[model samples]
Target: MTYRRAAIPALIGGLLLAALLWWAGSSADALRLPGSVGTLGPDAVAELQRWVAPWAYDPPSFLDAGVQGHGYVLLGDDGRDRYNGIYTAGLQIRYGAVFAAFVLGALLLIRRLPPVRGRTTAAFLALWAWGAAAGTLAAAVSAPWFIAAAGHGSHRFLPQLASVTAAGRQLPVAVSLVAAGATVLVARIAAEGASTPPRTEVPARAARLAATAGTAVIALSVVVLSYQPVAAALQAYSPDGGLLAEPGDLLRQWLLLGAWDAPAAGAVVDWLLHRASDVLLLAVVWWALSRLPGLLTRVTLPAMAAGAVGATVLGLLASQLLRIAVVQTGPQQGLLYSSAAIGNGIPAALTCGLLAGVVATAVLRLSLRGAPEPAA
Candidate 1:
């Protein structure tokens, strides 16, 4: 492999990760927002709020959504000071370790899968595994960090102690149902792929294409992640402030995309649109890798190139699901779950997914080399 081979991925992942941590760690409140204008403001609240929304869960009991969202945030002045501690060093290491684990774990899962069909079959399993693994990594890293950073990394203090409101309780069943629906969908997909056979090598052409694609993933992820600081500044300085504040309303303001804007309702729309953008981006990565064809000798490269697009979609969607599902409240902020919103989680998902997709394709390419040829 060329010296550029190693440098490409390492540089991308490293730089992207650094910028995100810097932004989140810079100000405690930046990671988490106190709240909106509320009918009433807590004298103890870090920032005054004329309005407040309940957490995802119904409140009345302190542990519910209402309190967690506002309690710590409204915890007066000393609360803010205590929230600003620097266990960030430890959290940084934790995030890195989990991400590395996901990448390596995915490769290991591929090595262990039974047998499968053509370039696409092997590629699909690999894509799914890589995506699930990447998402799992982000969840593992961020979830714990969120839980800990609020309370000296302890079990009893952080999210548990803060109080909440009762709005979330209006339909507790509905909230659980949404969460359950998402989990079931994710689990069903994972289980289906888990039953797939082990694949040992990808086709020669597929392998080459995957390598180039993987290289591209590293490059693309780096560029996008690096620009996060710019995105953050934009969201921060804006009037409504933050992407989710009124995404439908905010999106209308983004007439910058020319003809590509069609936003929907609610916070979930943000998820749907963000993932859609991610898929679009993955398509671009697909285009980038596809353009390198003909120079590489592998006949199978074309199919694998197409598969790269699928891999990109899977890589990103999986991460988005996890980052969103996991409870990610912060000290000064309500929920710092997404990187695009707060930490580098969104970028992490995008890049990590891309990396996994390329790796999966690469692995499929390796397997294709040894498998019997498909019918002409």
Candidate 2:
């Protein structure tokens, strides 16, 4: 039951999960071009060249045309269809593996720790570490697929080719870290024994209110910033010679600027505004459950599930409102166009909020469940 003993199972679970993710990710698509230019007609090759021309980083040339032609041969209509199927399947496998691994790892680790005060923190830390470790391993093992998919020709087409590749490669790693964090939260809550006494309700309520207020402020700010004129003004005054020339361009520029200046204090504020609701949803779920012990204890799973749904609904509503606001205040045509980006609309916000709420509920339950009864 010691940390040392518990770590063995954790390590094994992490390794197994990592291996599964790597296998799924790598095998999701054929890594190489499917065919060669020799198999295609000259006219077909010329059309393919035109299709990929915009993506080319260098001056248009016969060599570039050939390379692009080869790429299309590999990823023609059939290849595209196959890639989609494989990618979807891979995603399911990866998510399932992450979810199952976290639940199993959390239960295993929870049992090993002494049932004492502060064990929740310990459990959270353990789960977080395990998730991160597993994710890192999966990312490392899955590198071959991404590298092969990028191919030599991709470099010639994209100016920030290396950065793009790195970002692609890091997708699994980010997913793993997030999965781990959520698992820890859920496990922490579940580990709290059924009969354990509840803490004072006042503080939980207060915290929830404060979190709600904070979230509201940030969401409003984001909506305001998304207002086309406001966004244009911000971009114009920004240090990096604002790039918000066109209507839909503000959102893209904001995102790029945020990424480029992430280390800066201002960027941190932007990040918070972008993810305010998700960040605050933890407090909302925790307090809501605290106020309703029956929901927290008897229907724990259902409550968490509901929280996820609620988060999604709230996110969508917020997004819709923002869209309406943008349209009312800005140009009509590009009003809803930028909603596809993260922090700009419903999908990303809903996803982030749902995950956070579910995880927070789980961890809060474990934390509340106190020490296990001693055996005779």
Candidate 3:
């Protein structure tokens, strides 16, 4: 089968699987997981209620269920819904779209590979297992983002999430993982027996050198662009805000814009806009990186993924240094927010990197198929 013929079908099937996964994940209350902070008590529960009361009508169900119940609480919480009628569908769509992006990434990688002759059932099972494994890691690493989003206004959101959700976080994660795996399986079936086109060749040495340099550039760009948010979040936590006064209190602040005092509608809009911008920027960076010599080679998908993740980690380290610089410049900068934002953004970098690599490689190979090689 031609690449185009297979890709379109594969993408369609993959998206259907992604939608199914999102639906299942969003419908259940106990699917989302919190970190391993042990448990909670009455005081902890009350604190959680106060922080989440602005947006969530039922703080207990919302926090206890983690991401799973966020939609229901905001939209389906009867008249107690406290979202001020500004954010219901948008919130739900944004959350589910994240999981769908995971599915799309898996499909991109699978489509790049040559099809194999195997029973459809067996292919589905194998692909599903692999996808589930990936989903589990994504869910685990992204716990901080979800936890913070739920209870960002509160200083104790993380612990409260862990306490309220108890052990229920595992179930939603498992179900979402299972759904994620299905997306992979469907993509594989759709692309069965497909063949790849000839690709443009570059000198191996040149390719390696170029990829290395490109990766470094990507890392630096992330650090520089991210400094503003990091600085803003830190400044928001200063004495000027009357939020915290001691360096010891910095870790308690959620790494988000100080939207606690903003109107619920405005806060939700700002947060979503920030999220969309980050994703768009990362995608653009990855797309450009994938086009660098040899980075998107068929056999190098794993390397591309690893490189993307490594760059994100390196950028996070640089951001920490930047934060330290700001602290050294002023005695009253306080401890500010933790490096949670960078840590939370890793999964996005990984998936987007893979998807970009696959797409760039495909486009280049297809475009150059019948062109004459440059005379060397």
Query: What does candidate 3's lDDT look like per residue over 1-376, in tens digits?
Result: 3445435544554455445545543433321223211354444433333322322222344433433234543333443333222234323443344345444544444443323343233223323433333333434443444444443435444344333322222222234345534544554565555443333365444444444444444443344323555545544454533324432222222222111222256477654444444344444344334443332224344534433433333333344345445323355332222222223333333443344335433444444457654221
Sort order, lDDT high to low = 3, 2, 1
Q: List the RMSD of every prediction in angstroms.
A: 18.4, 14.4, 14.4
**Estimated TM-score for each candidate:** 0.28, 0.33, 0.38
Using TM-score as the measure, the top candidate is: 3
Better of 1 and 3 by lDDT: 3
Cα lDDT listed for each candidate: 0.35, 0.37, 0.38
lDDT at position 238, candidate 2: 28
Candidate 1 lDDT, 82-197, residue by residue in tens: 34332243345544653454334333322222122333334334334333333334434444434443443343331221211111111111122232233223323444434333
lDDT of 2: 0.37
Q: Top model by lDDT, which number? A: 3
Off by over 4 Å in 2: 1-17, 31-201, 233-376
**Residues 289-327, model 2: lDDT tens digits:** 333222222324433333332333333344334434432
